[model samples]
Target: MSWIMPRRSLGHAISQLLLQFRIVSAVARRELQLRAAKGLFGVAGVFLEPLALICTFLALRILIRGAGEGTYLNLVLWLALGFIPFFMFADVAIKAIGGVQKGGDLYFYRRLRPLDSLMGTSLLTVQIFGTMMLAFVLGVSFWEWEFVVENPGRLVFLYLGIGLIGFGVGLTTLIIGHLLPIVAWVIKSFLRRILLWTSCIFFPIRQIPDEFRPFILWNPIAHGVELLRQSCNPAYPAPGVSAVYFWGWVVGSIGFGLFIYANSEELLFANEPLPGLDDGDADL
Candidate 1:
């Protein structure tokens, strides 16, 4: 019976792997279908918003030609790389949290998990926007300026860093989304504004006031932008940023998300009756 036992174990392992693959695939498919139904309008924000910002920067460049040491092209690139990711991550976080609440109808579907929905949506946004940003960067390089990514390693590291930051931000938003619905929405909006201002999207962190420099350095978006700049711009004088710090933020945010998920039912559902069901036996 030893051979039979081994065969059963193999079957069990295969079943588990298949289950996981199915879950991920299902989630991904639903996400794609939902976004697809929105047609161009849903996904257009990913490209159009960044392009509009780039055009505005280009115009500003013409207006400020002799004034600043930094070129408008670099600023546009920096903002695109930095700001686009922030918006993508933030949207993922907010939507993930809201998806859990809104997905009550689908809760009965055993194959789906709240995390899966969140992740699927997040992945969809990243895949759409990340591709657009890369294409824009390459197109700008070919058309507007002469630029090349000389160090492939550094470029990869930078991309990883930005991704981690996005994941962390998204996870944090999920936690907040669970805790306070309306407040979470407001906070999400405020955080996006703060990310834009502190991200060094249009200007260098070094250009900030001395008193604010220390606090600004602590901003994760600033670190991400700096890291991206280091990768894309050889003209950048400083050494590349420390990857450990960026990774730390990612890990810490994920850990916090897991912690929140573990206790989410308690934090999210305290004093709130289930939807459409009242504490009393009678229907509302």
Candidate 2:
């Protein structure tokens, strides 16, 4: 006598979603193929750029204070630790905003979706940069330098939190930028530049003068970098950093981004231009 339809199980839904891993992998493979075309070392472009920047800074540090056995190792590790996370966040966020437009042509294929494009770019970013971090760590290990981890689990969570912040910002910005091309340009020029300067990439948060600590702590990335340094070296002092606030930014960014994205996903596929594109080009 029951007229109700059978209920779909959450477990089944999760399993089905997990199956999409294949799609993610396929898209990621295509990106890798394209990058590989640049030649043998071409695939390393993203990682190399960041590593080069860090080394430039390290060279300056070495020149100022003559290199000792442990001095270069310590400085390099500290810079690497901060650089990896910040660049990961920056790279993913920036690509996420433009992922749709750049790969819009791909979504024409039945298996691809808007989120798939973002996921592919993110995967590429992580793979290249993550491998770069591993190589740097191994080089240090080869020299037998001591870089003990105080909280391995916390370090991982914090790293992921930074990545989440990037994904969230990218997602939210992609949606807004999809509708308003100018919004994307403004953010690309301003917010990212501010974050790069203030994220404590070259120095520790504790090293900052007290006058600037308040403003610096407001940047969750500053906290992320400082906390990462302390995790690598307990001697690194970071008083103003707060895990709660850092995680808050991570959660808020992802939540807001998903919310906006979900509401406006249709615009992602509208071959017709979004609103702000005066020239009939809504994609930024």
Candidate 3:
């Protein structure tokens, strides 16, 4: 009877996981539809925003280092790898800042939890950016007549790792922002500006002087970007990045974020009014 109960419990857990996946998938599809309708060119607009940003940065790269700067790899593929992963990370985390308020209506379905909505957004982001990266790489490969990624496995691992870090950061920020609305704004700004420059999106870590190298190394996103560049071009020089350090951030962020979310999940459904939204209260 004991052994049979254990098997039943295992089956139940698997079933529950499948059910959650279905729910998240449904939410993701709905989000895609809404975003597609709201953007410039229907579904194509999903790729447009990132592509425009990439083009702007590429122009800057060409101005600074000439059109043929990346001797180890094509400049297009090189920048795409850095931009795609970092954008996915920033988007996921920033969107999470007000996720509870935005997704409050989703709780109408008893089966849908707050986590599911966030997970759905993360899923949508991963899909969009992953597709963009692939399209960019394939286009560059065809143009250059050479395969861009030397280690496809490493590229994928770093790509997914960065997304996981974003999801974790988003989850953590979502809960914290619920307690203090101002924090959401601050974090969003920091991610967009500070993190963008610090994440090694525009340059490789090898160029940094020794004294500044440690500062850049502290950012896990930098490690992921540098490692990704190395993964694409085996000859690419990445001196101080490590997969172990990057994964450490991945595990720590997700673990801590999950802990916070699990504890404060009930607060998400409170539907508390924003500071300035009250009819008679001072807008503090």
Candidate 4:
């Protein structure tokens, strides 16, 4: 009787349990709707940080007129292009943390996985805001600098690299947020400061002293920024970064994060009760 149950039936059940693509998509859509409900306030809050940054970069360009050799306009465009990925990275870090905490509610649903819920929210934000940010970048480039998509191939590669880095970082942050909910704010703040200074956001990497260059070059964000600049600006100097290094970081970080999540998933549920469930021993 058991043998006659059919191998296809078992395979289908395994696929459903392993992937749960439908559940992830549903959760992602729900997250998008929740965020969209906030309307303009949500829109403004999402873009304000990046907008202020662009203004500040432009202001500095004016203040430093005649102070250096590089073209200010080129630098502004390059910085803007590079900053988009960094902003995405930072957003992932912060939001992944929030997603973990907020996702306690979904844990009550037996079919829902914690990681799937977190990933769904993360993907929702990426899909919504990522397109908007990319459009804004292209619009600004076209209107202000007359930039055009000369090489679609390179642009596609650039986006692939950026998405890989973002996913790896976001997954790592989810694990960190789950583990250290209390000090997560402090940890994020400290990392943001370090990333800002080391990422060469305001200046060229060459400007850093030789003594500190070796250490600063270890930052994966720097590699991401450099790659973005290379894709955007023809005249931009190649930073001689190894693509292997960036990909390695992506693989390593995501692997570690998944291992942590798998090992501690039950603990996460045990430590924090699901949103609606009142019983102590309810399945997570």
Task: Give the top-scoring candidate (TM-score).
Answer: 3
What is the descending TM-score order?
3, 2, 1, 4
What's the TM for model 1?
0.75
By the lDDT metric, which is better: model 3 or model 4? Answer: 3
- Tens digit of lDDT per residue, candidate 4, span 1-284? 77757887998899986678788888987876666566565645544545666567556765876335245335445556555666666666666666666777787788787788877865665555466556656776677776644444665565555555666666666566666765666757855777877776666666677787778788877776666666655565645465678778777877786787787777656655557998767776
Sliding window of 10 residues with minimal summed lDDT for model 4: 66-75
lDDT tens readout by residue for model 3, 1-284: 67999899999999999999999999889888888999979888977787788778777877887755477778888888888899999988877776767887888998899899988988998888998889988999899898888999999889999999888988888888878878877888888898888888887787789899898888899999988888988889887898899999999999999999999989887755666565536555
Off by over 4 Å in 2: 1-8, 39-50, 60-73, 145-147, 273-284
User: How much is 94 displaced in model 1, in angstroms?
Assistant: 2.4
- Quick one: best lDDT, which candidate? 3
Worst 10 residues of 2 by lDDT: 65-74
Which structure is stronger by lDDT: 1 or 2?
2
Compute the lDDT of residue 28 as modeled in candidate 1.
62
lDDT of each: 0.63, 0.77, 0.86, 0.65
Comparing 1 with 3 on TM-score, the higher-scoring candidate is 3
Candidate 2, residue 259: how far the Cα is off, in Å: 0.9
Could you tell me which residue pairs clash in candidate 2? none
Number of residue pairs clashing in candidate 3, backbone atoms closer than 3 angstroms, sequence gap of 3 or more or interchain: 0
